[model samples]
Target chain A: EDKVVQSPLSLVVHEGDTVTLNCSYEVTNFRSLLWYKQEKKAPTFLFMLTSSGIEKKSGRLSSILDKKELFSILNITATQTGDSAVYLCAVEGTIGNQFYFGTGTSLTVIP
Target chain B: EAGVAQSPRYKIIEKRQSVAFWCNPISGHATLYWYQQILGQGPKLLIQFQNNGVVDDSQLPKDRFSAERLKGVDSTLKIQPAKLEDSAVYLCASSLVGEGITFGQGTRLTVV
Candidate 1:
């Protein structure tokens, strides 16, 4: 069975703290891994990592993929109250190019 | 460019009722996807369409759910006799093949 799992189902951090969210997957023909930040409305695209060891970054958010380990990590630095949202990890597989998503990690940044 | 568009941003219906949601993907995107997201979970793909044709619908509950993309641009997802478990956010997304998907402001469905 193809599946994606995320650790620390929920987290709480003070403003200015740094946090890491983890995602692991078991699927055939792994194509790419993506991270999304979902607020109350719609989930916004964060990053897409297709190669191992290469990090994708934007501002305070960064992510890396490990195809060999079949896992990925997303790091958020200097967290702010605005960063309080659910972070979702998803893996896309070559077979049928289906996307399997993890039950997101909910992070709450308190001020 | 305008992002993906979905209609009836919020809907409340009684169980066993029928309802429909619409989507208009970003212009020129060839692939469209419909997803169901229950509270505290990630979105689950319900169907995928490519240019008015169905690429996948294996997860869609055909017994009471049906979807169609007309003219390869606009799409609609309908649920008949919706169950309580069907209360969820219906997200519509679109992308070029092999690209990161763009999502719309999903419709929140509440079935009582």
Candidate 2:
């Protein structure tokens, strides 16, 4: 079975603080890894990492993948209350178009 | 472009009851997926449809959960004789091949 695990199940931080969430996966035929931010409703796409070492960034959020270690990290810099959300990690496998997801890391940013 | 659309923002039912959720994918998306998200957990894929065809459903509970995308565009998922354990948010998402997925607001199901 394909599995994805995330560390630091929950965290609390003050505004302007930085946070890093981690995810690791074990699966065959790994194709890509993705990060998503979910607030109250559904998840919104953050980044898709297909290659290792190269970083994908947008505004205050950035993510990088380490294929050699089967892990990925999402970094949020200068966090604000609006950044409080559950960050999810998912892995897509080449076999059968399946996506395995982690349990997610819930973040709370207080002003 | 418009994002994915799902209906019945929330529903509450008793065990042994039936409930259905609907989803309409983006105009040009070829792949659609249904996911179940329990409280404090990430969304888990329940089924995937590629142009109205079942691409994957390994995680779906076949005995009571069913889904169909008859026209290859809109889809519906039904759960019969729901159990308390089935309470969760049902999220619908769509994507083009090799593209990032766009999710709907989701239908929150609460089974008592």
Candidate 3:
């Protein structure tokens, strides 16, 4: 079964702190890894990583994938309360547009 | 540049009751997806449609769950005799070829 596992299921940190979330996957015919931030209802797109070593960044958020190791990491620098949300990791497979998603990491940035 | 649209932001029904949800994908988007998101969990793909054809519905519980995308623009998902365990957020999303998906505010379902 294709599976995506995310570590640190939940985290709490003070404002201005930095945090890192982890995601590991096991699947056949891996295509790409994606990150999303879900606040209340919908999950907004974050980053999509297809190549190893090349990191994708946006403002204070960044992510990287390691295909060989079958893992990925998302980093948030200078986190604020607004950054508190569930971070999800998903992997798209080569088999007919299928995607496996991890349970997600719930982040709470306390002010 | 409107995003994916979904209706019935919230629904409450007794177990064994039936309910339906609607979704309107972004204009020209070829792929539409319906996902179920339980509390504290990431979204799970329930079905996928390519244009007006069913591309994937392997995970969908066809016994009581059915969905259709007519005219390749809008879609609807129906759940018959909903169970308490079925309570969750149903998310609708759409994506163009080789593009990231755009999600709509999900419909929160509560089966009492």
Candidate 4:
């Protein structure tokens, strides 16, 4: 079974603070790693990391994958109350179309 | 152009009752996925389809749950004799093979 583990299951930060979320996975066949931000309903796509070392960024959120280490990190800077949500990391297995997700890290940004 | 769509934003049922949810993937998306997400947790894949063919469904509870994507577009998930443990948000997503999947708003089911 493919397992995805995330550190700091929950976090709280004041506005303008920066936080990093970690995700490590052990899968038989690895293909892609994805990050999502979920509020109340559906999760919104944030980034998809396919290569190692190269960081992908959008506004204040950025992420990087280390394939050799079998891990990834999502960084958020200048966090706002709107940034308070569950950050999820998922990895697609090498053989099937299935993707296994981590339990997620709940982030709370205080004003 | 449009995102994946799911129906009955919320549902409330009693134990042992049966319920069903629907999904419509984005146009031209050849791959579709169904996921179950409990509160405070990430989505878990229930099934996947590619062009009307089953790609994966190892996590689905076959005895009480069944799903289908007909004509490679719209899909439905049905649950019989619901249990409290089955209460969760059912999410529908679609992708284009190499691309990442796009999710629907999801249907939250509450079992009493």
DockQ (C-alpha based) per candidate is 0.71, 0.74, 0.72, 0.76
- A6-94 per-residue lDDT for model 2 (tens digits): 99999999999999999999989998999999999799899999999999999999999999999999999999999999999999888
lDDT by residue (tens digit), candidate 2, B1-112: 8999999999999999999999999999988999999999989899999898999898899999999999999999999989999999999998875676789999999999
- The parts of candidate 2 lying over 4 Å away from their true place are none
Instruction: Grade the docking of candidate 2.
Output: medium
Residue-level lDDT for A80 in candidate 4: 94
Q: Is candidate 3 or 4 superior in lDDT?
A: 3
Question: Among all windows of ten consecutive residues in candidate 1 chain B, which has the lowest summed lDDT?
Answer: B94-103
Q: Model 4 - which docking category?
A: medium
Per-residue lDDT of candidate 3, residues A85-108 (tens digit): 999998887766667889999999
Root-mean-square deviation of candidate 3: 1.3
Clashing pairs in 1: none
> What is the DockQ ranking, best to worst?
4, 2, 3, 1
Candidate 2 residue pairs in backbone clash = none
Instruction: Please give, for residues B1-112, the per-residue lDDT of candidate 4 as tens digits.
Output: 8899999899999999999999999999988899999997878889999879998888899999999887788999999989999999999998875577789999999999
Alpha carbon deviation, residue B31, candidate 2 (Å):
1.7
For the predicted complex of model 1, DockQ is 0.71
lDDT of 4 at B108: 96
Report lDDT (Cα) of residue B27, candidate 4.
Answer: 94
- For model 4, what is the C-alpha lDDT against the true structure? 0.91
